[model samples]
Target: MPRAQQIRSRSISASPFLKWAGGKNQLLKDILPRLPEKISVYYEPFIGGGALFFALASQRRFKKAVIGDRNPVLVDAYQTVRDDVEALIEQLGPHAAHATDAEYFYWMRALDPSSMSRVERTARLLFLNKTCFNGLFRVNRRGQFNVPFGRYKNPTVLNPDLLRACSEVLQGVDIVEGDFEALAERAGPNDTIYFDPPYVPLSATSSFTAYDRHPFGRSEHARLARAYRACLARGATALLSNSDCEETRKLYRGLWVETVAATRAINVVASKRGQVNEVLVVGRRQSAPALRQVGASGHAVTSSSSLRRSRAAG
Candidate 1:
């Protein structure tokens, strides 16, 4: 048996370990229903919290899973969780004990990740993610961890059971750190790819795409749109989630775009933490005999013809 598959453990359930911005835990209901019934390989390029990926893994929805992210720290954390959950938990225990201390939090945050080992770096990221302001993983122009202390009275920084479960789910899966465009290029026929790029700001002032040092501005979004289209052209089933705005709609025009209501909680402005509309753009290969779509209840609901009609009417 392959080394990746040899470590698989199906008895435990797994979920996202970090609190990520724009995590799709809330939108899984709408997103889950639209997935192709049969997926040979699954690709999630912008795997923020991997809410959708973990959910799909639990269902054994794909034969192979390839998940990647632009943030190296985030990617490292995933790898650490999969490869060395016990060591990560050991390192994180001290941080959890001092999570409420502002001085300790900033001290750990200010430490250079480049100077630490792989396990240390992952532990640092998990610690900051749990204790940072709003649990956001924002970086400065120089790629520095910049979010302030969250000041929560009690924060669960280490969950050994959750980490072990996540590790089991990650067995035999590809965890990469790189550009989404490059990752999307790997998808081909019978493959399903989900793109959850940094969303376009609703307004000029609401922009917060700085998940890393690189700014996901207009050009980046355009690049992503081109990638998404290219994936569809290559016979890969492509699905994308983005803000329901004129720019997003314009970019994904003529595709099967469905507006789904999502609740936003990460906004700095308290009033903006309410219901908002987001678009899910889906594209499947026309040559497929019968592309089946799974509904929220895990039942196949629609066929390729109806999906094509929806795209045509868009």
Candidate 2:
């Protein structure tokens, strides 16, 4: 077996997928157990970087899985990987070399996604994602890639094995490019929905991390809160992650919410790097963290449990 095969031998995990900021690489373990076992379909609408999809697809095979993103570039990248990955890898060759400057960022951004063939567009998205600052996919109000160049020495510009593995599970998934609310018409009972929306703006003064040019404001948050409530009323299981902020807690107060700290590269500022507390609000009730163990593997596990299932999938 090849080196990649050894990693694949483990259950589905959150690794191998491209690294991106706000990706759910951490904070999936506790959320997974809360998921119901009889769900016929798995749906993720706000699939930012899709850390959860890649993780869940590893162990179980759902009859139907739907993944979508509002960002057209992100959707195109997933489509190319599922449709034809070889061409994507080939198109990414030019960017495999290093070019750490703001000018290069614009140049890559300017390359038309539709002007190029599908394969070329897919390759461009992959290359920019690998080399861009903090693996972030951000745009300014004018829709330009404004993130600064990240300090990485020879990042994995392309991963042939990983793309192939991801394609295997996405063979028949309904990948779409649209708003999260667009799925409401098709969402049925017993479906599993894992939402990782832009958290209730951690603070009023925080930088713009909105999913799109239009900020997901308080009204939008209330809309989503109502949607989740409706989903629960209709018997759909829901698990969503948001910043452990007052607004978030207030929005989800009546529901069962548990706080767990999952550290990632969210804190761009040097001071707040290691630990960021996020709330995992579930439609179903959870015994408070008072009885759980904050595992080294980024989940709240039972303290007396013996089986140690790590979601890292490494």
Candidate 3:
């Protein structure tokens, strides 16, 4: 059978295929309810793991969806999942078979992505992501995949069902690869834009801002803030999340801000891994109402005492 004909077409629930730093998997319950009740178009500019997008997709929440990211490799992986999933899956089998061998993991990581075919590149990325340390997509200054091998007891490098489900949900979606500022021009009235840009580092040492070769610095944060405000001015509902720090607060000043607890999963010091407060900023069109506050587990935070109580629980 032809490769295209071999691909199955069916509706199945999906989740983010890759484990990403700052992914919204844990915050979905709190974030989902805050989305606009009716969405004409959905936009997620920094669609990392796309936890929110996949969740909304499963619910059939919008007429159409547009997802973008600055990282080309990441965008390519998503495209492969959407269009060339069968080939990508076939390529992953060998990787999965040898996933436990550290030598093979290092060899795969060292290979240049440009030298590989699209499906091969996508498969390599998936393999590394699943087996790499903490499942992080960190690259070195030379644009190399440098994360060490993770000694997982049984890492799942190939998930045919989840990939097929992702492909199905992505049937009509438009995927873009570039800076998030473009959303200001692309998003308009009746649209809901979710900005999950690289968060401003709470402390200088805690920076996960090197998403790609380009570092998301303070200037990028300022530029994104402007783009976000522009989307709001153009009559779109915008939602964003970031570290609950003075810097992040300054960026979204005057916008509806909600504090929520999030577990810090990717940290060098194991002791520092725990529940931490993060801010959710909402910017809506003039007609939209203020966003309701939700705690870590998606329950409403009605009062200061309740907020304190929630923090204590975290």
| Top-lDDT structure, candidate number | 1
Local accuracy of candidate 3 as per-residue lDDT tens digits, 105-220: 99999899999888999999999999988888888888998889999989999988788888888889999998888755788898889998888888979888777889899998
lDDT of 2 by residue, 113-181 (tens): 667877787777676777777777777786666666776777788666677677776788899998777
Clashing pairs in 2: 12-58
Candidate 2, residue 107: how far the Cα is off, in Å:
3.1
Which 10 residues in a row give candidate 1 its minimum summed lDDT? 305-314
Quantify all predictions' global Cα lDDT against the true fold.
0.84, 0.68, 0.81
List ranges where model 3 is wrong by over 4 Å. 1-12, 284-314
Q: Which stretch of 10 consecutive residues in model 3 shows the poorest summed lDDT? A: 305-314
lDDT of 3: 0.81
TM-score for each of the candidates:
0.89, 0.83, 0.89
Model 1 lDDT, full chain set: 0.84
Which scores higher on TM-score, 1 or 2? 1
Residue 80's lDDT within candidate 2 is: 85
